[model samples]
Each structure stands twice: as structure tokens, then as C-alpha cells.
Target: MNAPQTPGQSLLEVVDLAVDYQLKGISLPAIRDVSFDLRAGEAVALVGESGSGKTTTAMAVAGLLSPNAAVTAGGVRYRGRRLPIDDDDAMRPHRWNDLSVVFQGAMNALNPVQRVSKQIAEPCMLKLGMTRDEATARASELLELVGISAERGAAFPHELSGGMRQRVMIAMALACNPSVVIGDEPTTALDVITQAQILKLLTKLRRELNLALILITHDLSVVAESCDRVMIMYAGRVVEDGTVADIFNNPKHPYTKLLIDSIPDPSTGKRISRPIPGDPPTLQNPLSGCAFRSRCPSAMSICARDLPELGAHEQGRVACHLYPAPAEARGFHQMGEVTNIMALENLQVHFPGRGGMLSNLFGRPAAHVRAIDGVDLTVRRGEILAVVGESGSGKSTVGRVITKLVQPTGGKLVFDGKDMTSVEGLALRPYRHRVQMIFQDAYQALNPRHTIFDIVAEGVRSLHLVSGHEAIMQRVAKSLAAAGLNPPQDFFARFPHELSGGQRQRVVIAGALAVEPELIVADEPVSMLDVSIRAQILQVLIGLRTQRNMALLFITHDLPVAWSIADRIAVMYLGRIVEIGSADDITFNPKHPYTVALRDATPKVRPMINADPLPGLNGEVPSAARIPTGCRFHPRCPLAMDRCRQEEPPVVDVGPHHQSACWLASTSQHS
Candidate 1:
């Protein structure tokens, strides 16, 4: 391969890099012809779906690739010198001094046994040849640089918050003052607010220290918010590369456009059901032409005959046959009349917390953890109502209560205009048949020992919904076919482990459909699946809701997912519904401060370039055992006033169908 052109004195350059993992005698190519340049103090982001070779490319660059993996072609160069990444001894000097890495999970990356200060000081003492006392002092200063208190440096990893732990990792990465930092999914598995804070911190440090940063992430919003340049990878290849503004605004590649379109726009309440049709090509069994030809919506005959080169387009460099790109837009079908199918009135689910033995002996009443406190919600037939919140916000609890998996401690649950909160024994049997649940982890929810047919048939058998051996089989086959698992007979005998993530989720959905429930409580059903498959599962749910006229109570933490699929949204905060309205009302004209923070924290592609750090919440969610006295969100609310701290706010009607439990809603609305 010919060498690529470099701009100025490139700090780091990757030219036609290729990597493959060897298993037995077979070689599976994980990265192919991946090349990019990073200048001093520049921020570049590698964005793509999971298993799209983003992580593999970063691992290769950092010399952290697995032993089974080998670089087949090209080289990684730092300051025009070829890096011996394959040779550990040769790369040792450049590891931390010239380049460093902040791994994905900070909690798992840090040493739990050692003090954070000691962990941060180790590199300084060993690499920089500093004294023990000097290293300790330097550690404190590094912590301060990341906005952590110097005194907290002595704390253990577990004692610090998620954001603090990440900050400590950043401090450690900067210990030897590395010129370049590669962060591999640095903000993965973090809350939205924490993600924003970390992104802001990374951007701040990049400018302050004049360090080049390579952010490897699946989240496009983070890339748009933090990076100067963007590279979209797919199946081990750089499909698109250009300035952030150029790519996001006018994406030339079909895959790049799909990714941007898939991101649920908080300003628009439209569900994106047009998922890329096929799975990514298997690298081991090398496909002949374009890797994305099977999934491309605008694929031509040439796409299958010849692979497209990463040639320059008007906007940027794109690997596609269709460009100047043709506009390809899709829309969803409208639902029928909205009639309330299920309602929760002043619902409360309080679990009694256990006290010490002394308190028990003294007959002291145990304190209660108000999991769901006076949350009034409704689900209309054929409509998707999403309950969104951070962890421990009681969104899942509400779903459980609706499905009767966990009984509510107080208030009423009305279904089909009938009060069924207090009903028990045989009287409650019908309610169970009318409401079903779809769990988040499809692998865990499904029994490994059971076959696909047995899993789906179990529900029909237990409820006696169908009779006879053949009748049950017919019912199971029908449900399976409805869930997009066509040719049901083919999948009937397959085990849970044998199926893909998307297929397993389909099995779970088939089981729910077997019961023919009027309302389905789906709790983060697609969170574990890939972004491409997530759209498929969401499409299945939306189709079932529209075709079956069933009400769906969708509980999730992802704002974009909620915006994409939900007709109405209920934003939960510390067990209460802070905001409830149509998706448009909640997304476009939010009234509550918590809702606003959530929207702002969500990364989205802005029309113009934004240099400002994304705004983040002040603190983590408070403990459910000891929630704040008045408004539970007041502690971290940006619009919190004295009255907010003093009293619990009443739910005020902010719009036609919008209600917000916020005092500031009365004075000023936050959009």
C-alpha cells in the first residue's frame, strides 16, 4: 500500500494498518487499511456500532492487543518514527511518557486494594524517577487538576463515586505528561450526567495540557460534543472521515447516515424503525465485495462486484457508491384512538429498611425506602408510554408493579376501567393473563435448558390459554411468526445459547405474545443488544403495539430510545414522576429542571460547532433509603430555590397534556 499524505508535523500517524486474530489455523481480520492522523492538541473521535472494529483499532494503537492478534500490514508512527507496537520491550519507553491510555471501565481498571494516591504515584516514581514523597505530592496535584480534592487522593477506589474514579484514572494517565491520550469508551456504563462531566473534563484537559486525544466511543453525541474530527468505522474499515461539522451535517456514506439518523432526537418524537436489514459480515469467511452491501438501503450491483475505496467527497472522505448521497427518508404509521387501558393513581411502593439488632430489640419502627412515591401514570391502548430515569429512580419498579411481579404498597392500580390493586387469588388470575412482562436481559430471562417452543409454550400452558398438544404448538408457532422469527418451525428446536442476541430477544417477545396480554411491561428490553439490533427489537415492539392494539409501558434510561419509540414520556426522579407529557411536549418544551438537565446531558449533533463544555449535573442520585425531605431532586437541581428545598411541589399542568412536579414550572419553563 502507498503511504498516505500527512498534514504538517503529525504527532501520530497510522498508515494502512491491518490487524488479524489467529484462532487455531484460521485468521480473522479485525482491522483493515485503517489510517488517520492526529496533530498536537487535536481531538479526534472514532465512532461506530459495537464490534465495528473501533476498540480493536484503539487496542492496536495502544499496544494492548491480545497475544493472539498480529499486525499484518502497515505501521503506527509517532513523530515520524515507526512504533514497534508488536515488541513490548521496544514500546516500553513510549508507553506512558509519549502515549497513554484511559481504559473503558474505570471501576475495574483501578486497583481496589491500593489507595488511589498510591496508584497514581506508582508511574511517577517508576517512570519519572521521583522520590516516594515527591510522587505522593505529585499525585495530589494531578487529582486537583482533574477537579478532585487533593485530600481525596488517599481514598480507595470503592470509596469514590463513578465520576471520581474516572477522574483518578485520568490523573494516572497524565502522570508522566504524555503528549497523546487514547480513551477507549471512557464514559461507557456511566449515567448521562456523569458522562457529560467526564467529556467536559477531557475537553478541558486536552486544551489546558495541549495533548492530542483519540476518543473511541459508540456514542455519536459525545463525538459531536467533544471532538474536532470524526472517523466512522465499520467491519474493520474507516467508512468515513472528516471534520465533525462536515460529517454530521452532510454524511456521504449510508452507514454514517444511518448511525446519525438512529440517534433519537430529543427535539423530535419520531420512532426510527428503519434498521439496517442484515447483520455485519463475518470477517473470517471473507466477503468478496463491500462489507456493508447486505445492509445498505441503496445498494447497487457494483456494491457486490467491487469494494468502494475511501475516496474524497465534497463533504469529506467516504467509502460508498452512492455519493453525492441521495436522500433516503422513512416514516412510521400513526396509531389509532387513545383510550386509557391501565392507570396508576397515587401509587406507592415502600420497602421497610432493616435497622440494627439494637433498634429491633428496642421495638423501633424500621425506616421505609420509598421506591415509588405517589406516582400517577397512565397508559393508553395502542400507545407506547416510556418511563425514563437514572438508576434507582423506580422506573423498573413501576413496570414490575404494573405486571404484578411486585405488588404496590399503597394506592390503586386500575386496568380496563376495573380496580385490581386489592384483588387476590382466583380473582386476580385474569389480571395476570391481561398483563405480561418483557425483561431487560434476554439471556438471563430465558431458561438455558428450555427449547424455543417450550419457552413460549410455558406461558400458554400455565394460563390455560390454549388446549391440546397440537393447539399449544400452533399457538407457539403463530406467536413466533408474529415476532419476526419467520418460518417458526426452523427456530422451534433451537436453544437459547444457540440463537443470536436479537433472536433471543425475539423468543422473549414471542413468549409475551403467546399470552396475548393487553398491556406489556417491557423493561429496558433492548439495552443489552447492539445498536443495529436495538432498532429491530424496537420495531417489533412498536409493530405489536399497533397490530395487537396493546398498551406498552416501556421503561428505559436512554433518552433517545424513549424519544424514538414512545408516544408519551414520564420522566422519573427519586421515585416520583417529575414530568409527564406527549413526547413532543416533553422533548421540545420541557418544564422541569431535571428533565432539562437530562436533555442537555444527552449528546446530539448540533447544527453549528460548539466549543462549550456540555453541562452536567452537580451530584449523583441520592440514596433511596434516605431520600431528601421535600423535592427529592432539589439537591442536584440547577433551578432549585429556597421553596424547592422547603416543600414538595405539586404536579402543575404546564401544557395541554403535560404535567410537571416542579415549583419553577409556575414561574419559568425550561425548554
Candidate 2:
């Protein structure tokens, strides 16, 4: 904890800055007149969905511009001096010493070749002009300061988990104790506990050193909890800017309002979230006037004439024509429907426990662990059925079972009338195409050496019910376009290595669609993407359902996404669906305590983090290798009684299309 203090006044000032990237013969403006200030001990969060140019702005501020990118207009002043964007040599001295960047994605940001200590010490020895011994000592101190052990400093980037690597990255950024610390989606790779830890570390360090933070993130919850000020960006423009309290309380922009309203709350069952539709305008060919005009709910005829100027409203500001004028919202589907695309009757995934010899001898069936114990559900056609749960709640197992990636121990899966339990081999292949799955990790799911065309076309060629190279390529192009890749001709030839994380995911989605699948099982599809692009990919899924009538089984720990997208929500606890209902019923009038706990744990735009969600779903999800007895959640259930430990409660229907598998829900109504 002996890392040197970061000092100085209003640490960094980015005023009227506009940046452009050299593309072929054209210059594409990436950041447009972005202005912000950061002072010591204050955190300014840049909030936006993907392709908003938040990262480009941050990169410019950090002076990490490639030769391809240049500041087209305005400047970044650090403590009253303008940063030299053109000359790297001129910016060298101030780069790490004044403004240091902690990047997103622990997986990619850290070098595979270097160890954690070495990475931290590399900057220390090189940038800070420290001796090896001094650098090592500082690195150790920094690691400790970031809640990592000095003893584990020797671990390589791969050796440490994602969160640990992020902590290492933070430690490296702080190794020099730079005057200004810029965190770019720093907590994106982490889970809630790890996110909390990282945010706490950043806050502690900022306070201790009086350091200024320009935190870039998509999560409003993070902004609300940690940031003092927020700037909402869209398509390279700041649409809204304000104090967190001001913006959340009085969201002026339609995008801002949708962002706030789309968030989920635990006390309420499920909210009718109005997810903003349409993709952000192509940065390469950005729309004239307001970039958001095409997607804006309050889009007026005049909105197309000229870009709306940033107008003051109370304490904050918004850049929308109808802010002071009332206008009708567009592209929101409030009512959700369920029509049974796939059904699982008593779907159970069980593995044997550790009691080998004695259990075998006594013929106790090796003691089933019940990963998806006796779960029955239906995914309606053209509807999103979000399966919400904490980690280890069997939400993922259910997805895998439906995809036939994992064979269920007991159950009948009726996919458009075909029984999954008895289907196998060639017969299974048909069902596989009918219900495809997209994994959370795009890099791992995709072949590294393959081109975007090859990766996406692989599914088309493999599924081969058709013709020649031209025909296959045509299908590939169509699939890619369907998954949101514009001008498919340009993107098809590109390789995965050449694409960004969001682009890679789109390629995967395109691959999933190439088979012309009726349904997609997305296991945290957007969790790995940047905040800006995450919503875009999610909308792509929703749009697919709306346009092409593709059913989606969205399995995620992210409840807000579920609240926003899911038609029917199934709240899983331990290994079973503790609550099942229409999205309205689940978000507005949740009955199961587990459902309530999950809703509470998840952060919406206006997150109430001060209130603990009746204590952390309490205890680890009972091991799938050796699950507990009776009501599967009895060990952790807040309302568990003696009878609950010995007897399982049947799912009770409290209202139309609402069911909760809790003795409380079932018995409370009777009692």
C-alpha cells in the first residue's frame, strides 16, 4: 500500500475535441466535439452503448493514437498545456506520467508473453526511471493495494483469472501514480463481486491519491454508484451530460430515458422495458444532422434538418429536439407473447456424487446431483424466454440440454413435436440446426485462423442442402447481413484477428444464422462485449425475433437484459425454475423469494445498491456433483421451515401465467 500519491489540480481537460481516422482516401470523424474536465478525487463516467466513440475519445486523451487517427479539431489540455496528438515524441514524457490508461478485457489487454509482476514492473522501471528493486517493491505494493497478494505477483496473465488480471492491469496503471487515471470498461470482464472489489479499489485509490478518473462504462449502475458526473454518448456524439442524480431523476433524451427505464428492479416482478431499437448509424457513413434522429422516438421532421444543439435542462443537458416538447415514442413492443417453440418436460441433468464404493455397494444410484432437476418449460416461437439465475443455477445446463450439447439425465424435449430424449446421431443433426447455440466467448468459439467468411460459411457449407460456391457465398452474405454486418461484401473477406470483439460476435451470430435456424440459445452472448456494442448485439437478437420470427432462449446472469428482452422469464435457483411467468408478471409482481433475490442483486439504471438483496442468494449453489436434499434451495432459502427441508413444494399458480415453486407462495395463498 506504499504506492506513491498522484497530485495536481484539475488533472485533465478535454475541450471541444474532434478526432478523425484515415480510411482509404476519406477521413472519418470518430470523436465529435467532445468536451469534459476531470479533477483530483472526482470520477467522470462516459456512458454509452457500443460504437459511440467513447473508446476512441479515451484513446485520444491517453495519446495512444495510431498514425491512422488524428485530432481533427479542438485539443486535449493537461494542466493547461495542450497535448501533442501528431508528435508521439512530444507526448512521450506526459503519456504515462500524467495520464495512464487501464484498458478493458483482461483477456486481451495483458500480454501473454509476460508475467503479472513483470508487466507491472515494466512500466515502473521504464516510465518511472526506477531501479529493478525499487520497481519490484512498488509493483508488490500496487498489487497489494489493488487487493491482490504480493506473493501471487509472479503469476502470469493466464495464471490469474479475469478479475485478477484486471487488478494486475489497474496495479500497472497505478505503478507510476499518474496524475490522471483513465479506466476503459475496467470492470467489464468481472462478475459482481469482482466488479465491486475493483470499483472499491479505484475509489479507495482515487481518494487516497486525490487522483482524477475518466471511467468509461455502459453500466448505469456503475456510474450511479461510483461516478460523480456522466456523459451519455451515441454515434460519436454526447447526447446527454449531467450529474448522475440529475440525469437518472430527470432523463431528458429518449435514449437516456429508455436506458433508465429498461433496467430491472427486484422488489417489482418485471417491468415493461422499452428497449431502443435500430442500430447506431454507421460511423463510416454517419447520418446527417442528429445521428440518433433515425432511431430517436421523438424524431421530428426538423430533426433531420440539423443536429440538435446541447440544451440545458435543470442541472443537466440533452441534445434532442423534443426534450421540452412532447413526442410519441417509436419501436417499442410492450406486450409479450408465448406460443411454445420448444418444451422440456421434467428436464433433468444429474451427475454422480463422490460416494463411490459405499454408494455403489448399497445401490443408492450414486446420488444424483440434479443440475437441471425436474425443470419443465416452453420457449415460444418468435419470443425471447430469458432464463435468469446466478452462476451455477443450471440456467446454462438447460440451454446445453436444449441444444443437445449435454444429454439430459431424464426428460422429454419436444421441439416442434420431435422428442429430444430419444433422438440421436443423424436425427439429432436436424434439431441441432433448428436450435443453434452461441457461446459467451467468441474467440474460443470461432477458429482463430479462419476468415469471417470462412467461419460464417462453415455452417452453411456443413449444413449443405444446396448448391455451388456462388450459392454458398450468397447464403453466407445473406446470413451476415441478417446478423447486422452491413455491405457484407466488405466484411466477409476479413479475418477474426482483423475484427473487434463486437464484430467477432456478429460473425458468430451470422454463423448461427447461416444454418437458417429457427431458434438461438445465447449463453451470455453480449457479456464479453464493450458496453456500447453490447446493446447493439442484443437488439440484433431482438430484431431477429421481430423480423424473422426466430425464437431465443437467452441464458444470462444479467437480469436487466432479461427484463428488457424476455417475453417469459424463468427464475432458476440451484437447479430448478423457482419462478416462471410472463415478463410482466415476473418483473412487476414476483412471487418467489429467489426471483426477488435475483432481481434485487442485478443493477438497473437507477440501482439501489445501498440495499442488500436479502443477503447474497445465501451460500454457494449446492454443488452439481453433490446437491442437497428436499427443496433444492432449502439450505439457502430465507423462508425455509422444517417441512421445507424434508418436502419439496410444487409450483403454484398465483395468477394468469404466473407460477412460483415456493411453499410460501403456494401456502401463503391457501393459509
Models 1 onward score TM values of: 0.50, 0.51
Reference-based lDDT, residue 505, model 2: 92
lDDT of each residue in 1-671, candidate 2, tens digit only: 22344453565677656788888845677877677777777889998888888988898888888888987655677766777865788988876778889989876988888778888898888887899999989889988888889999888788888788988888888887687888999998789998988898888888887888999988787777787899999888888999988887888898888788777755567557667888888757777657888887778876764456565666876778776411111112221222477999988888766677877798776656768878999877666889989888999999988888888888888988778787888877777678899999998998988888889888777777457988778788878876778789898778888888988899899999988889899999988888778977876786566445578899988776786677778999878888988776776578877777777766577854233356655676777766666787878778788878888889999888789988888787798
Model 1 lDDT, full chain set: 0.84
| Highest TM-score scorer | 2
The number of clashing residue pairs in each candidate reads 0, 9
Off by over 4 Å in 1: 1-337, 357-363, 605-615, 669-671
lDDT of 1 by residue, 5-59 (tens): 2333478888667788988745677887777889887899999888789998988
Tell me how far candidate 2 lies from the true structure as C-alpha RMSD in angstroms. Answer: 27.8
Q: How far in Å is the alpha carbon of 2 misplaced in model 2?
A: 88
